[model samples]
Target chain A: MKAIEIDNLSKSYNKGKVQALSSVSFEVERGELFGLIGPDGAGKTTLFRLLTTLLSPDAGRATVDGYDIVKEYHAIRSRVGYMPGRFSLYPDLSVEENLQFFAALFGVNVEESYDLIAPIYKQIEPFRTRRAGKLSGGMKQKLALSCALIHRPSILFLDEPTTGVDAVSRSEFWDMLAGLKERGITILVSTPYMDEASRCDRIALCNEGRILGIDTPHDIVRGFDNRLYGISAKNMFTLLERARAMEGVVECYPFGQRHHLVADDSFSVEQFTRQLSDIEGLEIASAEPTIEDMFIKLMKR
Target chain B: MNSEIVISVRELTKRFGDFTAVDRISFDVHRGEIFGFLGANGAGKTTAMRMLCGLSYPTAGSGSVAGFDVMREGEKIKRHIGYMSQRFSLYNDLTVWENMRLFAGIYGLNRRETEERASALLKRLNFEAERDTLVGSLPLGWKQKLSFAIATIHRPEVVFLDEPTGGVDPVTRRQFWELIYEAASEGTTIFVTTHYMDEAEYCSRVSIMVDGEVRALDTPARLKQQFAAESMDEVFRTLARGAQRGE
Candidate 1:
């Protein structure tokens, strides 16, 4: 049996005015690192709440570790660790106190799970006496992960762990997740960052509560069939407008220093260059499609 | 390339007791330039921005924003620039039209000018139909776009965006940049901060803060080459990795 199984799970709020999740379904293999990649309001959190049994789905059924989410809520809650999008540790409690509290709540002591959380906890161990709220963002993240793992959950659900964090700290958080994954924990994480999609074994590109596509980051890029090019000029704004106006150009988007222009086979580079010959310092090159490119393409469709 | 300098700082410093939050940062942002101000969390990017925005008084150094002296003309400086952030930029309960009118009024725009600007902005955003809709009801992407329009409504000489695209979707994030480019082309000097390295590359020039200092400042192309990194992310990582602070 799969570590997780969902069949057409649906959820909504405000008497169906919101429709937070719409018939979402996916599976997770045991000890696999799966990612839910999407921006805010993409229902990533809704799905997490449903699987964690915090809220019953409006329709459909799901199971974690062969246990029905609704019927086996107790089993699921005890076996799964969740780090919400927001920092949720007690502000008044010291780092060590919070860990001890969580462990005791689960009928275990800190020493029982010290081996499971030591890798993450040791970094913040020096601050054991500091209030959880007083720690820095990076240290706070480590503490939250440590508290979540104090019970040694078989599966982990991290919702937007890297949101609002700097790139350096985000990379560090992912490294911690990787370490946790190696301990044979089934991990399901969500992020709004397209760049972090590459770190996941498989990702579901979600938007507006719908899964656009689900595949390995490599396979998703390989699935992009359009001929995309990176085009830049002295005036990037004008370049974007001109690229969009040209016939056969499907989409033109500003990507970092240059614009990623998607074109059909009918488009010819020679003709494109000839058309924009008047534009100065123009540079064009075939570009590789990234996860962001694929996510945008899939979301549009 | 010699555009007029709109924002100039020299040895600008901000301190709280013994801790120096912004330490001797110096840079000049030219007119109509999109200048990216980047740094890790708790690296003093906020303190420096607060000083430039005339919100917090600096401990030492000299600077001017939109030609207003930072030490003396803080209120005058605030009047000449616009500011927006992902959070707290808009009121949830207010309708789009109401929000626009509120900001326009706060900026001291006359009644006629406010109406004209509102109509033009609504048209540009294709949001005329939603004028009466509550801002809280709009999607995250739409709210951000609307916030940008409102921030620039006064047509200030400079506008500062604080991570305006954080948590926004990919498609809408690009759309936000187009709005930024349009504003810059209209001769508005944009001072922005972001964690997205790709967005950093969108700037005409970028200044990265490390330990309260302007550690790296250059065009994205030059910075990448100087750091021997392939992407802005790599360059940022190289500079930020050496920081002594832990956030």
Candidate 2:
């Protein structure tokens, strides 16, 4: 049986006026690191809540660890670990106390799962006596992850774990997740950062109550339908405006050091090169689409 | 790059009790420059920004923003700078038009000026239809764009945007950058912070803070070359990985 399975799941709020999730469906294999990639309010959290059995779906059904989500919620709760996007840990409690309290609630001793959470917990163990609220953003993140894993859950669900985290800490957090996956634990993580999609074994690109696509990061990039070009000039702002105004240009958006420009078959590189030759420090090269590029295209469709 | 300096700091420091949040950081931002201030969490980026914005006073050192002293002329500094953060800066309960009026009034604009600016802003954003709608009801992307627009409504000499595009989609993120460029083009210096490395590359110059100090500051190309890295992300990781103080 799959670690998680959902069929036609839908949810709404404010008396059906707000649709948070719309007929979302997917599955996660045991021990696989799955990613739910999307921006804020993309229904990532809504789906997690439904699968974790915190809330009932408005339609359809789901199961986790071979148990019905609604009918066997108690079984799933004890079996799966959930780390909410917010800092839900007790702010007043010390790091050690918080971990102990969570472990006790799940009827397990800290020693029982020390091996499972030691790698993360040990980094924060020096500050075990510190209040959870007093910890820094990165330290707090580490503490939260330790607590979520203290119960030795078979599956882990992390919601936007790196939303406001810095680049360095964000990279470290992914490395921790990768470590957990290697220990035969199935992890379902969500993040708003597109670059993180590459870290997951498979990802579901979600947006505004819908899933845009589901595939490996590499395959998704390969699925891009257009020939993209990266163009950069002294004045990027003016370049964006001019590129978009040029004939045959389908799309143009800033990507890091250069602007990713997509043009139709009618686009003549030789002719455009002559037209743009006068611009100072101009460089244009064939570019490969990233997951972010594919995501924008999917949203447009 | 030759524009007049709008923000200048030397040996700027902020300390609380035994902890030093910002320690002797110094830099200069030119007029109309999009200066990217970046760092790991708890690396003093916020503390330094607060000092510059006149929200918090520094414990030591000297600085000036928009030609006003950071320590003695905080009120003047506040008047000449605009600020917008992803977490706060908007009135969710108020309609789009009402929020505009509120901010404009606070910025000391006259009724006639508020009306004119509000209509022009709405039209430029093609958001005239949503003028009466409450800001809370709009999508996150729309709300973020509106917040930036309102932050610059007074045409301040410098605008500080704190992670203004944190969780927006790719397309909307680009749109936000377009707005930043537009504001800079009009001579509104942009002092922005973001975790997005790509956004870092967009800036004319960037400063990466580590352990309560400005460790690296240069143009994106120069920084990349100096660090021998292909992208800003690598440079950031190289500098931030050694940070001992992280929250």
Which sections of candidate 1 miss by over 4 Å? Answer: none
For each candidate in turn, the TM-score is: 0.99, 0.98
For residues A171-198, write the lDDT of model 2, one tens digit per residue: 9899999999999999999999999999
TM-score, second chain, candidate 1: 0.98
Scored by lDDT, model 1 comes in at: 0.92
The whole-model lDDT of each prediction reads 0.92, 0.92
Largest DockQ belongs to which candidate? 1
Runs in model 2 deviating more than 4 A are: none
For A81-151, candidate 1 gives per-residue lDDT tens digits of 99998899999999999999999888889998999899999999998999998999888888888888888
Q: Which ten residues in a row have the lowest lDDT in candidate 1 chain B?
A: B80-89
